[model samples]
Target: MKSQEVIFVGTRSGLRLVLDAEENIENLKRVLERRLQEAVGFYSGARVTVETRGAVVAPEWIEEVRSVLAHHGLSMDERGWDGASAGSADGGASAGREPEAPPDGAGQDQSLPGADTVLIRRSLRSGQSVSFDGNIVVMGDVNPGSEVCAAGDIVVFGALRGVAYAGANGSADARVIALRLTPTQLRIADKITRSPDDEVQAPSGPEMAYLRDGAIVIEPWTTHLGAVFGV
Candidate 1:
């Protein structure tokens, strides 16, 4: 059989399936089924993420793809849908889903490795999406309608109005942090949260997001918290 073009990119973090945004929804469904069957068992129980690469996909189409993957015992990981941390804060990970803020002056976050860093120097407007297999640091604002997804942590030096995902590969320990954190949605590993409809206020400073009791929680950030996040 001939190989499929622009299929999937497998990275250390997980599998990034380059979904065809241009194809008709039904046709795309058939193609995805066939392609997944061909590569079945090879990625047994692996974490999978679908990327349209600028193509628009309806939620129904995505559900169809997820159905196919589920048939192959591959579950869809929606944690990093341009998400960060456990909530809308620092992009880091946890074990017991307990808040793991650095205990006051614990020095550097020995857990953060230097290898997982992706730096974006520009602002991200709506409809723009950035995905990486590591941590994401945006030097500019992440405007509403934009999204950022990563397998590790996420840190935005400016406003973070978009969605952010951290630990997309199933590591609950991941966290998300932003200078001005008013995100549309936030995710860390398997947990996700959005701001309440009645809460229209924004934090005056930076914020961190992490897991707390199996849920994502966003917190006001302090210098000590920065040190724990290795900021």
Candidate 2:
């Protein structure tokens, strides 16, 4: 199989296998199975996300991919399966349904773990996205043109250049964190804000993005910041 035909990306969120849109699903599965066997144990017990973002495969074929992954010791963990996300992969939006609404006074306890959390270990490239109904932790950067949206807090251990929306379910209390907090756009619940256009670059240490009053604010990330937000 060609390298781009079936690519596997490792993220803190788990191992994401992105299948090319043009490839035949049957051929894709066979190619994937062979590749998995060759790289045995590389993705053991890892929760997997199949990215057919722009692919034509229907809901049933995704099951085939899942089965193929299961054959290679990889399967989606039930705990990490956000209710809103399943076979749908278009920027984390669920297929044919509206995102569920959060409870009243939702942001009161952002750390309550009311939903599932997903981790991606690598930086997101252009046009790639990850969405979930719970917290999302990306171990790498989120490059420009990519996006990460979550119903809860979003934590990127690396830079965030594209866009990120936290509290997607409408919790103004949701937060965004990154080693470099410069985002083209930052969103919390229903509000939206962009990074300053000043010449000053991002600070040396980590930064936190949260809602202060009616605007989004970025502050130096510290050990106790989570406590301040009840996260």
Candidate 3:
């Protein structure tokens, strides 16, 4: 089995995925499919960048690779091609280039009706803070001392060790979901809760926190509650 690793390359648009050059294309596709399967909710409507670090390749190969990604509803942006000369046969100098930003107000938000969902693909280290007006879905861990606040729900694919506040704008229906729910402080709407000092050590699993009666209550996530919770 091939171990999948994620490398972040910060850019103007957003973070880019740096795929290993040595890995075969099949393995790359498999890794991407697995990641999508694991975090379907996070990637449902997210835009991603698939970056490379070599000269531009054949157009057919690029199209084929892109088709594979499209099957999973993932968009791709090619970048990092500085080796080929201007007149090289590798399809001109603009083969693998970053896309220019859209014109002002072309794609900007305009009082959208649906709530925005921010998908974070990297870990939140100590001292890092994320604040958004809508829901937040983090695909990585939230380390201690970090803070995440959203006006809607909060979903952490990994461990939650920091402080998280869902429904910060007073939406009592918002909830917090995490794979490992041992947070220093957790809040839903106006209710707040903290992990007990003598916390019981147990296997980590999916859990959810929501407002119950007048207080926040945590419970294990189950598929059977899908209809009741409207999840």
Give a tens-digit lDDT track for model 1, residues 1-231.
753433655443455565555677677777777876786444445556555543445677678878887888677767433322122232222211222232111213223322568899999999998876678999999999998887788999999999887776556777888999999999776677886788777799998899878999888988887787676
Candidate order by TM-score, decreasing, is: 1, 2, 3
Residue 109, model 1: lDDT of 27
lDDT by residue (tens digit), candidate 2, 1-231: 366768765432334566665687788877888888886544544455555443345557667777888887677543222322343454333322322322112223334423678999888999998977678999999999998987678999998999998876456778898989888899876578987788776589899988889788889998898676666
Q: Model 2 — TM-score against the truth?
A: 0.51
Count the clashes in each prediction: 30, 9, 0
Off by over 4 Å in 1: 1-114, 228-231
Candidate 2, superposed: residue stretches over 4 Å from native: 1-114
TM-score of 1: 0.54
